[model samples]
Structures are given as structure tokens and as C-alpha cells.
Target: MVIFMLVKDVMKKPITVKDNDDLTEVIKLFREKRISGAPVLNDDGELVGIISESDIIKTLTTHDEDLNLILPSPLDLIELPLKTAIKIEEFKEDLKKALKTKVKDVMTKDVVVAKPDMTINDAAKLMVEHKIKRLPVVDEDGKLIGIITRGDIIEALV
Candidate 1:
């Protein structure tokens, strides 16, 4: 017999983050919960965006335009170790600034969501089409209720 599984049956009560929350605290939460991403909620508790490890990684690799445009002098090039040390120090400073960034600054604002009554198969198709791993499950009034992930669907099938 074929069973039709709805998103509500497998979706987990979402662990959400506030849009104005700092990245440093969000990172701590992600680590503690062992979650790769979470839906961003506003003060009114509406899903406003989504954040993931991918977004954090993007911040790390964001290059400084001025730094990239400058060409090191011949003397500076000869002092390779000194150049490397300076670069490391600058990178450290950048990381510090990045950590203080707010969730809204880096989150994907145009979020794709799923309804609780939606079928698991349909949700999976949405995941594949959007190239996303999770979908925030919302209510009729577009309020976040839970989260559904690829893992959840896989586990439900087993």
C-alpha cells in the first residue's frame, strides 16, 4: 500500500533566529544545535529570510576591493614573510567585523516555503527545483510553523 506523507507529519518545530541577531551568536546556536541553517524571523515572528553555512562562508571570502587593486611594491614583494603577516592581520580584522554582521545582512531574503498539508513528494520536488536543502513550513496566514529538510523526508520514507 502506498502512503501519502504530509509535510506536517515529518517537519520539525523550527529552531529560528532573529533577523537582527549577530552572526557570532547565530554561529554558536548552529554549533550547539548541530543545524546547518535556520529560518530568520522578524520581531513579529514572521519568516523573513533564511541563513546557512553557505552564507557565512560567502562573508569570509568577501574581498576588499581596495586591497585587491593595490599592487605590492618590489621591496614589499621581497619581504614575503612581512607581507604574509600583514595579510593575516588584516584577515583577522575582517573576520572580527564579519562576526558582528546581522543575520538580515547575509540571509536569503526571498525565502521559499512549504505548507503543512503538502505531500512529501511535492516538497522534495520543490527542494530539488530551488536547489535548497530545507523549506520553512508555514500556516495559511504565512506564519512559520515548522521546518522540513531532505533528511526528514528520507527518514520518513525508511
Candidate 2:
């Protein structure tokens, strides 16, 4: 199918975070916006990076990479529920602690961006190649103006 749609046709104003923003604030912004990721901007409002739930998840789990959070055993049946509850509480605490860091520390600096005039097909290609869910739409001088995502493209196409 030939798509004449341009990125600007479907791009939405970006929900952004500052480089120095604390993860706590960023996390809250994400939750409030119901967004999985956002463009990161510098003090001069230049798009510098991108932060996503993957970044937060990686930060939260610096060490606990093993899936062996709990082991199943016949003798452990009675303790499973209590252990699970405790693990959940511990994870919450870890999340709070992880928020002490700045957004720049964990944000992906090597971001792939889209131009307003770019075709939706081209933008989709970039996203697929970069394995990113969202693409920041930047102007000629690289100023972030809007953002587009897989969902946005799909919605627009339909």
C-alpha cells in the first residue's frame, strides 16, 4: 500500500523530561501521562535522549537478573505466600531508591528521530530498525516538536 501520509500528520506534542530530572519525577510523569517513554531534553530544550520503561526496569534490576526470585519446593509451600508478599514490598522499596538517580543517567543517548516531512512509511522503517516504540519528531535545527508511535501510525492508517 502506498502511504502518502507524513509524520506531521499524526505526530502529537511530546511529553518530555529534562536531563537533570529525578527519576522519581520522571516516573510520576510517565504514570500520569500513561506513556511508556518520552523524549529527554536539555536545559536549552534540545532533544538529547530518550527514556523508557526499559531504562527504568534496567535501573531497578541492576543485580536481580536471575529469574530465580523464588524456587518451588514441597517444603516451601507454607512460606510461599509470605515470601511473595515480602518480595513485593522489597521491590517497591527498590523502586523508590532507584528514583534517586537522574534521568540522564539511564536515558538512551543514541536516539533515532524523525522529521515532520518524513513519510509515515519511512518513519515506521526507522522505528523497526531501531526497535523503538516511539519516535521524536524534530525540526531542521533538531528541536523536538512532536512525537509519533506505533499506535499513532496504526490509528492514523485506519
Candidate 3:
């Protein structure tokens, strides 16, 4: 028998970032939590935007023309020799500037969300349609409550 499940049944408590949070702090949070993205919330705890690893990488690579030349593509940095690509001091200074940059500055503002009552299958279809890996689950009032990931649906099926 196939069972339909609601988002609340499989969603995990959201790991959120504040709009005013420093990019450096956000990056640290992502690293520590091993998350690729997070919902950006305002002072009232309302979801305003979303930030992902791609955004951070874009910010780092595009901020300076020198940096952009060194790491033309996001993956190029991994293959390029770091010492030849950028000086340690320059990289550190860039990181410091990045740390001061607010999450709101780099977050994707036009966000797609899902209600807690939405079915897992429906959510999965929405994700596929939008080409997203996850969806933030919101309450009737539109407050972020949890997040459902692609992994969640697969786990539910198992």
C-alpha cells in the first residue's frame, strides 16, 4: 500500500540565517552544519530569502577582478594552485570583507515555499519542476517552521 505523507511528517527543524548576519558567520554555520543552503529570516522571523553555497562562491569569485581571473569557475579553484592564484594576505582581506557582507546582500529573494500540509509527493514534484533541492515549510501565517529536503522524500519511501 502506498501512503501519502505531509511535509511536517518528514521535515526537519530549519537551520536559519538572519538577513543581517555576516557572510563569514553564515559560511561558518554552513560548514559546521554541513548544509549547502539556509533560509534567510528577517527580524520578525519571517522568511525573506535563501542563501546557498553557490551564492557564497559567486560572491567570493566576482567581488574582485583579480579573484575572478584566478578562479573563473567555481570548481576551478579546486584545481588551480592556490599560491599562484592569490596571495594569502589578499585572500584573508577578501574573506574579511566577505564576513562583513550581510546575508541579505547575497541571498536569493524570490523564494519558493511549501506549506506543512503539502504532500511529500507533491513537494517532490514541485522540487523537480523548479529544480530545487529543498523547500522551506511555512505556517499559515507564512512563518518558516521547517524544511523538507530531497533526502527526506527518499527516506520516507524507504
Candidate number achieving the greatest lDDT relative to the actual structure: 1
Candidate 2 lDDT over 52-125, as tens digits, reads 99998788874544324366677677776787788778878887888898999999999999999999999999
Model 3 / residue 33 / CA error / Å: 1.6
Q: After superposing candidate 3, which stretches have Cα over 4 Å from the reference?
A: 1-3, 63-92
Worst 10 residues of 1 by lDDT: 61-70
lDDT scores of the candidates, listed in order: 0.91, 0.90, 0.86
By TM-score, highest first, what's the ranking?
1, 2, 3
Work out the TM-score per prediction.
Answer: 0.90, 0.80, 0.79
Q: For residues 22-49, could you state the per-residue lDDT of candidate 1 as single tens digits?
A: 9998999999999999999999988999
Once model 3 is optimally superposed onto the true structure by TM-score, how far is the C-alpha of residue 146 displaced, in angstroms? 0.8
For residue 39, give model 2's deviation from the true position in Å. Answer: 0.3
Question: Pairs clashing in candidate 1?
Answer: none
What's model 1's lDDT at 12? 100
Best by TM-score: 1
**True-vs-predicted CA distance for residue 147, candidate 2, Å:** 0.4
